[model samples]
Target: MKRYICFIALLAGMVACKKDTVRKGNDPYRETVVPAIYINKDGISPTRARVGEEVMISGKGFEKNKDKLAILFNGVKAAIISLTDTTVRVKVPAQAATGNVAAQVDQQYFFGPFFRVTGVFEMDTLYPSLVGANGAINNIIPVEDGKYLVVGDFTDYGNSGKKDKLNRVARINHDGTVDGTFGPDAKNGTNSTVASAVALPQSVNGYQYLVAGSFNNYEGVSYVNSVALLNNNGSLAANRIQSPNGKDITVSALKGGVSGSVNNMHVQPNDGKILLTGNFRFYVQPNFNLKTVGTDLDSVHLDSIQVNGLIRLMPDGGIDSTYNYDLAKHMGKEGANGFIYRSLLLPDGKLLIAGSFTKYNGQAVNRLARLNADGSLDASFMPGAGADQAIGNMERQPDGKIILTGSFNMYGGVKVPHIVRINENGTIDPGFNAGEGTDGFINNVGIMPGGQIILSGVFTQFNKLQRNNMIVLNADGSVHATYNSFGGFSAVGDNGANGNVNTVSRVIPQAGEKSLLVVGSFTKFDFRTANRIVRITYP
Candidate 1:
C-alpha cells in the first residue's frame, strides 16, 4: 500500500510540473518544443510570379515523415496542387470572398512535441488584350435590374457600323449585350436629346430624368442646342417644375442660350441639381415657355470657342437662380481655359476636376483641380501624384490612397509605367513600385473589395516578369502569383488607315464572377471575337 501511494503521488507531481511549465510560459524544460518551419528552398520565397502561377512548399519540417504531417485549408483537407519533400503548392479557390484563407500545417515530431503552422493563399488576376480607340469613358452608371448605362462618343465598336441610335447612350447588360428595351434598335435608358456628357439617370418629377448637355443650338427641328431630360426608357424625358424664375427653356432650345455648349456634367445626389460645364460665358437656363431663339448659329456645331462656366438645375428640372456661379473665374480664370472632362466629388464635399491645362486659378496646376461645390477652387489639392504623366483615370483606393493611370514614363526618376499609387497627401509611394524595366500605359483602374487592384489598358508584361494586359496587382503592388493563367500573346497594331484609333481605349469590370468588360478598337479579342466591346471569363 505504501509503494502504490508513493507511485501515485510521483506521477501526479510530474503531470503537474508539465502543465505548470506550459501555463507559466517561462520554463523551457518540460515544455513541448515545436520544430521551426523552414523553406527547403534554403531561401525566401520567389518574388516574381505570373498569374495563375503557384509556389512550391517542399520542406523537411512536415515532409520528413508523412505519418506526422498533414495540411488543411480553412480547417478542411487542402486541395494540394503539388507537394514534395521540400515544398507544397496549392491553387486558390475562386470567388473566395474578401477575407483570409488560411493554410495550416501540422507535423508530429519524432522527439515528442508537434509542429503546427499556417500561412495564406493570395489570389488575383490580370487580363490583357489588343488596343483600341482613344477616348474618355463618361457617364457610366448602373440602371434598373442588371443594365449599365454608358454614354460616350464611341459610336462604333471596333470600327464596326454600330451607331449611337438613341443619341449617345446605350443600355447594356453585365454580359456586354445591348438591352433592346431602351431605344430604337438601340435603347438608352436616358434622354433622347444629345448631351456631350449626360448624368447616370434618376427617377424624378413625373418621369425619370436623364440630364443631357449640348454644344450647339436647337432649331426645334433637328438642331437641338440645350439641356434635355428624357423618360426612363430613352423617350424624350420631361421634367415638371414651376420654372423657379417664372421662365423655363424646353430641352430643345438650350443650344442658343448663354451657356449653350455643355461638354461635361455632374449631378448632386443631395438635391438632384444638375451642374453643366462647358466653354460658355455664363450659365444659361432655358425659358422655353417664351419664344426662345436657339444657339448663336441655330446649329449644334459652333466653330468658335464658347463660354467656360457652370449651370445649376433644380430637382424639378428647373434652373436654380439663387444658387449659381461662374466656373471660369472659380477655377482660376487663367487656368480654366481648357475643357473639363473628368469630375469627382471628394469625400470632404469638394469637387475635383481634370482636363487639359497647366494652371489653375492663376497658379501652376497640372491637368487637375479641386473645387468647392460653390465653384471655389481648393488650393491644397495639387498634382497629388503622377506629376510626370497626364492622368487619364484616377480612383480612390479603399485605403484612401489614389491609383492614377496615364502616360508619364519617369516616376520618381524610375521607369514604372502603366500604374502608380500615391499616398494620401499625394506623395509617391516608394514601397509599392511595380519594379523596373516595364513599359505600357494604364487606361483605367478600380479596386475590388479584396484590396486587389484591377488595371486595364495596354501592356505586354508586368513586374519585369509576367505577361498580362488587364492585371490585378496584389495590395502590396506585387503581382498576385495566383492571378490569371499564363498564355501566348499576339502583338497587334492598327492595320487600318487611321493609325491613332487602334489602341485599348479602356477596360471595365463587370458584376459577375471573373467577368469583365473590355472596350477597345481591336476587332480580334483574345484572338477570338471581332467585337470591340467584349466579355471575358475564366474557362
Candidate 2:
C-alpha cells in the first residue's frame, strides 16, 4: 500500500512540473505587444494647405523618439516642426505634389486621408518672356497701373513671338511685356545702357521717373550722364537735371574725379526733391545750353564745380543748397572704398543712413547714423558702439521702431544677432532678441500686414534652426516656428548638398496678397528650379 501511494505522489509531482513549465513559456512580460498608431483623433483640421504652410497632425502612439518616426506629404518628406507622443506639426514640403499624408512609426505605417498641396505663388514665365538675362536685374520698382520698372544690365526684352532691344532700363507691364511707350525703341542705336537705380514717380499723375546709372546718352541723341528725368512717353522731360554750376556728374576710376557709381536714390516724401548716395566725389549739371531747358538737349559736359557724393536735388534738377550734408566730412575713411548703401526718410523728417563707414560728422559711429532734416547729426539719438560689421538694410515700423539686418553680430555693446530692432531713440529694444541670429549676411527685410518680418540673405540658419536663405519672424523676435523653407534657396542641379542662396537683393510683399516676391541670383527655391526671381506664398 505504501509503494502504491508513493507512485501516485510521483505522478502528481510530474504533472504539476509540466504545468509550471508551460506557464513559464507563455509569460505575459515576455510576449511582444506591437505598438499601434492612430491618426486624426480630432479629425484632420485642414485637408488642404499651400506648400510651406503648416498642418497639424494629431494621433496616438507616435513614439517619443522623432528619429523612430517618418512623416511624408505625398511622397516627399515633410519637415517636422514639433513632435510629441500624441501630436506632430509639420510643414508641407515645397516639392510635394498633391498627395496623401503618411506616418511611419517603428515598423508600422499609418496613412491619413488625401490632402491637396497647392502652389503659393505663380511664376512670370509666359508674358514678360524673361528668356534669361545676359546680366542681372539690379533693382525693380512697382509703378502705377500694375506696371514694374526694371533696371539692370540686360540689352534685350521680349517674348518668343516678339523681341524688344531694351537698354539697361525698361518698363514692363504687369505681365512682363515691355512697355513700348515708356522709352525709346531699343534697336534705335542705344546698344548698352546700365541703370543701377530707379525712383518712383514724384508727380501725382505718375508721368515722370528718376533714373541714375552709368550712361552718357539716351535714345542715342539726348546727352545725359548718370542722371536723367524721363516722361511717361519715354522721352526726356521738359526740364534737364544738372549740377548746381552746370557740369556732368563725372564718375570715373581716376583720382581727383568722381570715383564711384550712384547705387541708390530716394524721393522726398513731403517734397518732390531727390536724395542720391554713392561713392562719387562730385556732381556737375548737364548743359542744355538754353535759358529754359526742354526735352531735346545739345551736349553734356562732366567738367565743372565739384560736389559731395550725397546731395539733395530740387524738383527742377538743381542741387538743393539749403539741405547740405558734407559727405566727405561725415563719412570717415572706410577701408576698401566703403560708401552708403541705403538710406530711409523717417516720418518725422529725420534721415537714417547705413553703410560700412566708421564715423559720421567726425563722431565715432559704426555703420548706422541719423541726421536731422537739415542734414545735421541728431545729437540726442545715440547708437552706442554701433554695429560690429556693415549694415545692409533698415525698415521702419508703425510704432516708430527700426528694424535692421546685416552681417553684424553685435550692436551698441549688446550681443544682437544679425537682425535687431531699435527704438526711436536709437537704443536697442530688450524685447527683441534673436539668439545666435543668422549664419550669413542679410540683404533685405520685408514686413507683412501684421508686422511679421521676412528676412532674405545668404544665411543658412537663424537662431540655430535651419531656415535656409529666407526666414519669417514674429513681431516679438521669435522664429516663425512653423515656417519651413524645405532646403531653402539653391541653384538648380546642385545635387541637394548646396542650399545656400547666392544672393537675395530684394524681398517685396505683394499688395493685397499674402505672397512675397523674392529677387536675387539664386536659380532655385525650396529645392525647385526658379530662375533669379520667385514669388513665395507666406502662410
Candidate 3:
C-alpha cells in the first residue's frame, strides 16, 4: 500500500513539472503585440494635394515592415515612398479622388479624414488666342457676380482653334469665355488701347465701368483721349463723362511724350470719389467751344484746371479740390521725376502711396509715403530711407500690415531683398523676414484666402529657394515647402527670340475660393503647355 501511494505522489509531481516547463518555454509577455495600426491625428501635412504630390500620413504603431503596410487614397492604392514605425510618406495616386485616406497594415486597417485632391488649376480650358506671343494680360478684376474684366495688350481670345477679336479690353464669363453681351460685335469694341478698367461701386447714370487707356474713341465718339464710362451693356455710356479740364486725362511717357493712359485708379468706399494716379502734367482742353459743345459734354466743365500726376474727382467727373496733394511739388528732382505705381486706402481714412520717389512734399521721403485724410503728409508715419528701388506693388494684410514688393534690395537700412512688411506705424516688422527675397523684379503680390501670399514676376528664385517666376509664402514670411509644383518659367527660343520672355504680369485671387487667376507672358507652367492666363488651385 505504501509503494502504491509513493507512485501516485510521483505522478502528481511529474504533472506539475510539465506545467512549469510549458510556462518557461512560452512567456505570455513575449507574444508579438501587433501595434494598433493607425494614422496620426493630423492626417496629412497638405490637406489639399494633387496627384504625383507627396503627402505624409502619421499615426501610432506603423511598423517598419513596408511589405506588410499599404496606403490607400480614397480607396485607390497609392505608391508608398517611405515607411517607418510612426510615419508613412506616399505619393498621391492618379486615380485618387476626394475622399478619406486609409492604411492597411497586414489585416489591420486605419482611416483618416477626407483628403481633398484638388485640380492643379481652376480653369480647365486655356485661352491661347487671348494673348499674342508678345502680348500679355495686364490686369484681371473679379466682378461681383462671378464674372471677370480682363484688360491688356491682347487682340483676341477663345480657343486656339476658333479665335475671336477682343480688342484690349473684354469681359469674360466665369467659364473663361468672352461675354458677347459686353462690347459691340466682340471684334472692334474699343478703338485703341485700354490700360486699366474699374467697376464703380455706385453706378453713374446706369454706367458702371470706367475704362482708361490710350484709346481716343469708343463706339465712334471723338475727343475721348484717355477716359470713358461704359454702360451696363459694355457700350459707351450715353451720358458723356468729361475730365476736370474738359480734356481727357492724358498719359505721357515719363521721359516726355504725350500718350493718354492711366496706370491705376482707386474708388473710395464711403463716398464713391475716384482717385486717379499716373504720369500726367497739366490738365488742358485743347479745343474748347461752348456753342459747338455736344450734349454729352454740355454739363461737364473744368472747375479746377491745374492738376499734376494725381487727382481726385467726383462721381459726375467734377474735380474734388477739397483734398489736394501737390504731386509736382513733392516729386523728386527735375530730370528723374517720381511716379506713383500703387496706392492703398486704409480703414482709418489714411492713404499709403508707393512708387519711385525719393521725397514727398519736400520731406525727403523714400519710395513710400503716407498721407492723412486731408491729403497732408502724415508726420507720424515715416519709412526712413524707404526702399532702394521702386515699389512695384503693395498689398494690405487683414491685420493692417502692409506688404511691399519691387526691385528693391533693401528697406530703410536693413537688407530686405525684394519684399518687406511694414507695421501700421510705417516701421519695419523685423519678425517678417524674407531671406534673400526674389532675385528678380516682383510685379504683382496677391493674398490667398488662407493668408498665404502669392507673388509673381521675373524672379527665378525666392528666399534662397529655387522657385521659378512665381512663389507662395506663409503668413509668417516663410516659403511654403509643399507648394512647389510650378516648374518655373523659361523662354521658348534662344534668348527669347520667340517674343515670349517668361513674365508674370498679374495674379488675382478669387474670393471665396482656393484659386488664382495667373496672367503672364509664359506659354507653359509646371512643364505643361499653358497660355498667358491660367487659374491655379491651392490645396
Candidate 4:
C-alpha cells in the first residue's frame, strides 16, 4: 500500500514538471530584450523631407558609441550628423525614398513612422493647376499630334475662368489645357454618359471616332442610339441633303444601334468592324419616314432583335450580317445568361473574352473563353474550371501567353491569388508564379516592352510585400525592386481621411514606353494631390 502511494506522488510530480516546462517555453521575456534603439510611434519629425535635407529623430536607448548606432531611411542608410541617448540628427540619404524609417543599434532595431520622399517620381506640377473635371475621368485615349481625348461623366473641367461646360467628352492638349476646337458646350454634347470611345482606323473612316454608352442623343439629335460615329470635330457623323425649297438639311444616317450600354469598344485592326461587349440584350433598329420630316426621324416606330452581350458592327454602325450571332447567343439558358466585361482581339482574328460567365455556346467555360473568327466557341483552348471569380482585365504577352487580373483566389482549381498567367492552350503556366498573389483586387494590368508588368487597383500589398495600390512585376511574376523607390498610391489617413482613397481603373503605357498614364478615382498618389489622373515618368 505504501509503494502504491509513492508511485502516485511520483507521477503527479512528473506531470507538474511537464506543465512547468511549457510555461517557461512561452515566456515572453525569454528571447526578448528591450529593443536597444527605442523609437516612439511618431519619432520622425517633419514626416516629409527632400534628399540632402536634415531631419531629427527622437528615441530612447540609442547606442552610446556613435559607431554602433545607425539610421535607415526606408532601408537606405543615412548619415548621422550627431547622436545622443535621446535624440539623433541625420541627413536624408540621396537614395532615401518614401517608406518607414528605422534605427539600428547593434543587432536590435526599432521602427518609426512613414516618411514621404519628395522630388522623385512626383506629380507633374505643370499639369493644369485648376481643379480637373468635376467628376471621374473614365478613359484617356492618346490621339494625333500629342493630344488626348478624355471621356467621362464630368460636367465641368477646370475653374470658372478656364472651365468648359462639357458633357462627358473633351480634348486636352499636351500641356493639359482644354482644346476649344473639339466641340460645342454642354448644351450640344451627348445627352447622357459616354462610357467608351475608340478611334476608328483610317481604313474604316478617316480620323473619326466610335463612341458608345447609354446616351440616346448626340448634339441634340435623337436618332443616335447607344452608339454613334463622331467626326474629327466631335460632331455626330451625318449626311446633308437638299430639300425641295433648296435649303440644306442634315440627317443622322446611323439607323440601327444597340439598346443597352456598351462598356468597352474595340476597332478591329484587320477589318474596320467594331467589336462591343457589355450588359446589353438587344440591337435596336429604327425605321425613319423621310417623307414626314426631312431633317429628323419618326421616333415612334422601331425594331429590335435579341443579342447576348456581344456584337459586331460595320463601319456604318450597322450590324454585321456575315458574323454568326446564333452561336454566340447560346449561353446556357434562354433568359438567364452570362455577360462579358472585356474582350481582346488576337492577331489571328480570334477573340479572347473574360467576365462572370459560366458557359459559352452550351459548353461549360467557367469565366474565360476563346471564340473563332465567326463567333463560335474554340474547343481547342480549354481552361478546365477557369477562374473562380470575375476576371476584370487581361493583357496578351509578346510570346502568346496571357496575364489576367481580378478578384479571384483560384484558377482552374489551383491557388493563384488575384493574378495568373495562362498559355495559348488555356493551361496555367508553371514557370510564372505570383508566389502568394496580391492581398487585394487588381483591376488593370499593362505589359511593358521588356515584359515587365504594371498592376493597379485597391491593393496595399502584393505577395506579402508592402506595395500600395500600384506595383510593377517582373516577367516571371516577382515584384520589381526598382519600382519600390517610386512610392505607390494610397489614401492620406488611417481610415482614408478626406475621401482620398485610391483606386486605379486603368494604366496605359505612353508611346515611348518611358512613362505610364494612370487614370482612376484617386485624389492622391505618393502623398501628393494628383486629382484622378497622373503621368508617372521613368528616367
Highest-scoring model, lDDT: 4
Residues 215-244, candidate 4: write the lDDT tens digits.
887777765778888778777788775644
TM-score per prediction, in order, is: 0.57, 0.67, 0.67, 0.78
What are the lDDT scores of the predictions, listed in order?
0.48, 0.64, 0.67, 0.74
How well does model 4 score by local distance difference test? 0.74
| Global lDDT of model 2 | 0.64
Itemize residue pairs with steric clashes in candidate 4.
Answer: none
Per-residue lDDT tens digits for candidate 2, residues 1-539, read 99999999999999999998997785667778665777874345486778778888888766565787778765567888887778888888755544457888677777876665655333433432234333445667777787776666656444312245666666777655567766654432133444344555446646667777666555554445466666666555543345444655432211111224666677786787776666666656544434335544434344443444566667666666566533555432222135687777787787788888887656777888887777667888888888899887888888888899887888898887777899988889988876777877777787777788877778756766545577777888887644542445654434755544434566666678665666656665554555555656645
Q: What is the full ranking by lDDT, best candidate first? A: 4, 3, 2, 1
Q: Total backbone clashes of model 3?
A: 5
Q: In model 4, which regions exceed 4 Å deviation?
A: 1-56, 60-83, 88-114, 118-122, 158-164, 203-206, 240-251, 290-299, 327-336, 490-502
User: Whole-model lDDT for model 1 versus the true structure?
Assistant: 0.48
lDDT of 1 at 444: 57
In model 2, the runs with Cα more than 4 Å from the true position are 1-134, 157-164, 175-180, 187-206, 221-223, 238-259, 287-300, 325-338, 485-487, 491-502
- lDDT, residue 99, model 1: 15
lDDT of 2 at 366: 89
